[model samples]
Target chain A: MAVALAALIQDPAAPPARHIAVGAASPIPAAACWLVRKAGANVRLSLLHKRRGNPFTEGTRELFDLAGQGRIDLFFLGGGQIDGQANINLIGTGDWPGSKVRFPGSFGSAFMYMMVPRTILFREEHSPRVFVPRVDIVSAPGISAPGVYRRGTAQALVTGKCVFGFDPARARFRLVSVHPGETAASVRAATGFDYDEPATVEDTPDPSAEQLALLRGAVCDEMLETYPEFCRRVWQREAQERVA
Target chain B: MDLLQLDALASLVLDGATVALPPDNSLPSCALVRALIRAGRKNLHLIGVPVSGYASDLLIGAGCVASIETSGVTLGEAGAAPRFVAALAAGTITVLDATCPAMHTMLQAAEKGVPFMPLRGIIGSDILAHRPDWKVIDNPFAPEIDPIVLLPALRPGFALFHAEMADTHGNVYVGRRRELATIAHASNRVLVTVEQVVDFDLLDDERLAPGTIGGAYVDHVAIAQRGAWPIGLPGCYDFDAAHFAEYARMARTDAGFQAYLQRYVYSDAALAAAE
Candidate 1:
């Protein structure tokens, strides 16, 4: 997922990520951003989760203020529920206040989704429950009407199973690629929504030798402080090892 | 400026007042929060600046909150705020869901002494549907039918936080967390707890002036060293992840949450251990 997200960050179809902001509890996206930066991209990264040397002194409000004026070129967002139309639900399931099951309330997605020019919808978990046909609530709509002051829409939706490129014009998602172990059929079965798929979908490219090396070396080092658990789980690197 | 004790500072917050607090990453005065819980304060409405974290969650777990208005509530890396979720599930508290910028915008409006302020996006979100106070209207300046959401001003009754230090002049040095300035500006009263009380005025330094909230806005200052303990003060201490993991583990159920309150929130020995 990190490799896939890194590729999307560098995708030339969208605006250059001159300044990208990553929000809290987003280790994978943070890792992907670090991967792209370490791989020689000229992107300025503002990581909100960075414990030290944080970029924003004015608080998270500064990040939003910058995005409001169209300074942040790219951002990453995820949802407890994402729909075929690219709508996301961070609020949770059930009634108005999510009485049955409450996911964390929507953070900055409501504004950032419209303020920033590009957003990559990422959720590592891929299944019928998550990739629902219709979201319980629209925390942020994927497509706004023509007159609405929307700067952008979801560029792409990357999941553990596959990648779905979003079309704002049609408010739909199209299957782009599947992971190595997964097939198009498997993706279709797991997905609750209907999406256009090619007859022969390509397998997501594995991270190259250089990319793998960078992910383990410098990226792990950069992430150790903010995401010790992720590093330990994915790269088998311990936080104490950095101290040692 | 006179420095008050922790309990005296906590006493300024009357029951059922709307209080604004920064999230865990920023400086949340956990020490003051503990004092409030111990005082058995109830029916408090908390605004999580833009979101909630350890301070908000602990307050919810102890049944001290009647309502919470914020973007989200979580323990960050540790996981979902178990007590907050449990309270919501049990229908114990009113949840006023808001997006991050909306909360910031509402407070910014209050800072400007405006009735409301316009914000882009949230037009199609259900959050707008729930927030009747948030109005949508055609952009008067637009040539076409451009729509925008207008959020009403939210001036919290009290703005509470922990800072690295406060000086004799009463200006609290927040460093980069200037959103606290917005909170201080918007709220009716500003209460701050600091790690130290220096003899000199903070505004004497040019570099520090931009980051410090003026003494004029601050209503009270209390000296509580390690005021943001458990949730660290930026540049002063790192957050205790082991403690957070332990709290998360113990806060999963009502009984466990009670046990946690007994051990940490009410127990002075545990508080001393944290020191």
Candidate 2:
């Protein structure tokens, strides 16, 4: 998933991601950013959750200020529910303020999704409940009206099952690739929203041997401080330096 | 510095006052939250600088909060904040759902003493729909339709937080977490709790001046060593992850939450830590 996300992050079709900001609690996306950096791309990563050396010195709003000024090139977003039009619902299920089931309220998704030039939507869970026909609420519209001053929209939606390229013009997702063990039919069965797909959909390319080495070694080293549990779970590695 | 006892400082936060609090990483005063709960303060409105954390959940669990205006409230790594979810479910608290930048923009407006501030993005969000005070207007400078959301200024009744240190001159050094400075600047009264009180003026020192909130804005500074304990201060200590994990478990049920309150908040350790 990290490698697939990295490929999307470095996608030539999208705007160049010179500067990327990863939000708190996003381990997979953070890993992908690190993988992109370790692969020798001259990318600057502003990790909001970095405990020791947080990139934002002026406080949390500095990141937003930079994005508003068109400094940040890319960001990653996920939703409790994401619809066909790319509308994400981080606000809960039933009513306003999530009367039924409240996912943690939208952090900065309503702003970041519109301000950043490009965003990659990633949700590890890709069930029918998550990939709904329409989100209960729009935390941020996948596609805004022409005069809404939106900088960009979702470049692609990457789930555990497949990779979907988002076309803002049509405001629809086209299946780009399916992960191993997931066929187009299986993806169709799981998804709630309708999408486009080719005759012969290919499997998502596996991470190269070099990519795996970097992810398990250097990337894990960089991530140990912020994401020890992720490293331990995915790489089966323990933190060398005890943080607490 | 007009240093007061932790309880006395907490007392200044009267019932039904709106208070701004920073999240866990930014230095929330857990000690003060406990003090407020102990005092039985009611109907306190909480404005999470942008987002909320454990402190907000604790207050809600203790029945100290009437409403919360924040982007979201979570325990971060520990997962969902149980009490906050319970209160929301029970319709006990009014939730003014906001995006992070919207809250910051509102606070910035107050800091600048402006009526409102224009912020980009959020024009199409449902969060904008719920916020009746927020207005959308075309950018006057732009020839085309460039609608932007204008947030009303938010000047809270009190800005409360914990810091590493404060000088006798009342200047509190927040280190790099200048969001606390924004809170102090935007709020009506600034009440801070510090781990220690220093003799030297913080603003006089070049290294610290950039991070210090001037004493003129600070109404009271109380010495509460490890005041942000369990949540922890930025450089001073690490958050008690085990404790947090346990709290997340205990707070799932009302009975468990009350047990946690007796063992932690109302315990002797809380008073000793605050003193």
Off by over 4 Å in 1: B270-275
Q: Over 4 Å off in model 2, which ranges?
A: A240-244
The true-versus-predicted C-alpha distance at residue A96 of model 1, in Å, is 1.2
TM-score of each candidate structure, all chains considered together: 0.98, 0.98
**Each model's lDDT:** 0.91, 0.91
* lDDT (Cα, tens digit) per residue for candidate 1, span A1-244: 9999999999987778899999988999999999999999999999987878889877779999999999999999999999999999999887787866899899998999999999999999999999999999889998887788988989999999999999998899999999989999999999999899988999999999999999999899999888887899999998767521
* DockQ, candidate 1, vs. native dimer: 0.84
TM-score of chain A of 1: 0.97
Question: Which lDDT value does model 1 have at B148?
Answer: 92
**Chain A TM per candidate, in order of listing:** 0.97, 0.97
Kindly list the per-residue Cα lDDT of model 2 for residues A1-244, writing each as its tens digit.
9999999999887789999999867999999999999999999999987877888889889999999999999999989999999999988998787878998889999999999989999999989999999888889899888788888999999999999999999989999999999999999999999999999998999989999989888888899877767778898877775333
